[model samples]
Target: MRVKITKTNLWEVALALKILHFADLHLDTSFARIGFSSTVARFYREQLREALKRILKLAQDEKVDLITCGGDLYEHERYTSDTGKFLQGQFENIERIPVLLVPGNHDPYLPDSLYRRLFWPSNVKIVTNAELMPVWNLGEVTIWAFAHLSPTQREAPLNEFKLSDDEGNIHLLLMHASDMSSVPPGKPVHCPFKPEEIHRAGFQFALLGHYHQGRLSSLQASSVNVQESISAPGYGYPGTPEPLGFDESGHHGVIVLEIGDGKVKAELRPISQFAFVETELDISTATSRDDIKSQLQYWADEARGNYAFARAVLKGQLQPEIELDLTVLREAIGSYFRYFDLQNRTYPAYDFSELAEEKTVRGAFVREMLNRIKLATGEEKETLRSALTLGLQAFEKREILEQV
Candidate 1:
């Protein structure tokens, strides 16, 4: 797939140019706002939409030459006309900047896809075909992209590409694909490619989509011929532009790539309106609800990197006499953040070494439990340990009912 250009380099920047690349938005008006009342749902929907607006405006603010969306632009199954209009309207407002897009598994280009129905803005360019297509050439930059026509794609588009650096133009591949070597178990294996196949194909930057976590193939940046000072062999996933759930965490943002002047550099610009943060809080030393409240408040406030969706893990060994009323604690602190979940993983601080030496029934029970635990693996170990703790606590008149 080759695209021939007639226009002189569209961007007149001196060797350095910025391309804002992002993917896996999975925009759904129904999702991220489920189970709320109509009015409340609209409020939550607006929050997500507002984040998209900020991302679209970023291209103009950064003065980027091209805005590439790797894929999953919308939730295909749940897409509404309002969302289609909102997305296309935003593209219209992008002014004269170029917007390139491909469809991901969640938003594949089926016969009835929004890509086929809607009239996109003049600046928008999307590869709706299932094959490898290099349809755009802006003088110095060329883009080869394809869409996921179906959920199960066995074709390897990367294999069809053959690199020709003899022409000396910046070549980019925009598609939603899986790096088959390390794709996690059970993840939809769509448009898979082996790293060696990608390296052999020879595209400088492959802006891939689908996976929600950002990563670069090790081979993407390491292939160097001493003859060329700077190389474009590096490819990276920009991850989900805005984190959707607790599983999607850390710096949620877009990547700004500078691909000229004998070196290739990329910077992550975090522009999401919400960040998902899972905090592991050590509550072993927590003596009371007030203590837990103080720590929760501190982290809950900090988690609003914009607005936080937080899961606080209460862990470590708890003091024998102290009891944490989790329902009360959640009611008191849940309102501190946009989305909150509290997990009780704290264990009782038992003097096991001292108890192991005693000849009493409790000591015998502890020893028997310890012996069984040593032979167990996985969740079985944890279950047996909890059973022993609960059995002893019941014998000692320490049932957890009164605290709730």
Candidate 2:
């Protein structure tokens, strides 16, 4: 029972080796017990359950023979029997196809890990150690995997794997790692690895997990630390299958790779039970509280859904008399979606004529600050003025600067 998918000079098809690539599911079974009230925990539980169902349905629709789950299938180190039962039930639904897993940092391959105790489907293959473990060999293709289950947070043994065989069979390496220093600074370094080293390791394609934002890149490491031939052309991270937080947005999906004839074609397929969106609304002309609310409501209604999570930021000048009721707006927005944040940055319309005319020491200080503001960039001027205003208010109220 197999579908033939072949590329011909004139659109003819014969056979295609299709596999779905996805990672960082973060299916938190403990989410129900992690601080959220019983009701809220129930909500999280349902959401997680729905995501699993969605993935299985996706596999069925796509009719893939193999599903490559790079890693982080679960949230953490601990899982109750109930959670295990739920996972086993959901996985049973997906047992029709093979699922290849690479263990992530959170759910490492410790003796007590679920990967050790759980009786997954016979089609499931969990790579437990940092060694080349071959799972699938389809004539011209060979998939090799290495799982990083190191107990410590810092060391990554998988980074030592750098083997390249350009003329050999199609080699696929499955791993979960990061390039900490190479990425933008201030971000945490997790499962660090050198991109060029991976290319040197002689793999035709490296299926990676971790960093739940799906993206594809050539073998070239985007850094100066590692220098190697960049001709090897296979690298990517299939971000989380679903959005776990606000930062993960746009194109929440999975990658489908077709490997045959010593070549690979990748496509991204998006899936999510609930969508998350962030929007900015200019409030420069918003004259009153009612106006602001109306504008927000209009924008909210125009968004993807009434139940979608959103963050609306109001920027520009605002009248002093009007006070925006963020609480009321959030409630008004309804329960389908939660408004994570609403920030009002409308500056007050002001006349500095009186302050310029004053002769007191405080007035002189204000005058000096104003002179400096003239020479600053728009951003700098605004920041300085806001600071000065806050300081003045604190002085008048006889409050500490920190309190202000």
What TM-scores do the predictions have?
A: 0.73, 0.72
Lowest summed-lDDT stretch of 10 residues in model 1?
223-232
Q: Which residue runs does candidate 2 get wrong by more than 4 Å? A: 1-16, 29-45, 77-79, 132-138, 150-160, 164-167, 179-187, 219-232, 304-307, 335-340, 344-404
Top of the candidates by lDDT: 1
- Superposition TM-score, candidate 1 onto the true structure: 0.73
Clashing pairs in 1: 204-232, 220-234
Residues 247-334, candidate 2: write the lDDT tens digits. Answer: 6765555777776544666666766656567777777687776787788778776773644656667777655445556676656654
Model 2 steric clash pairs: 162-201, 163-201, 163-202, 164-201, 164-202, 178-191, 214-239, 307-336
Q: Which stretches of candidate 1 lie over 4 Å from their true place?
A: 1-18, 29-45, 164-169, 180-188, 194-196, 215-232, 257-266, 285-306, 348-404
Mark the 10 consecutive residues where model 2 has the least summed lDDT. 1-10
Model 1 C-alpha lDDT per residue in residues 197-247, reported as the tens digit of each score? 655665566777877766554454444211112244666776776676667
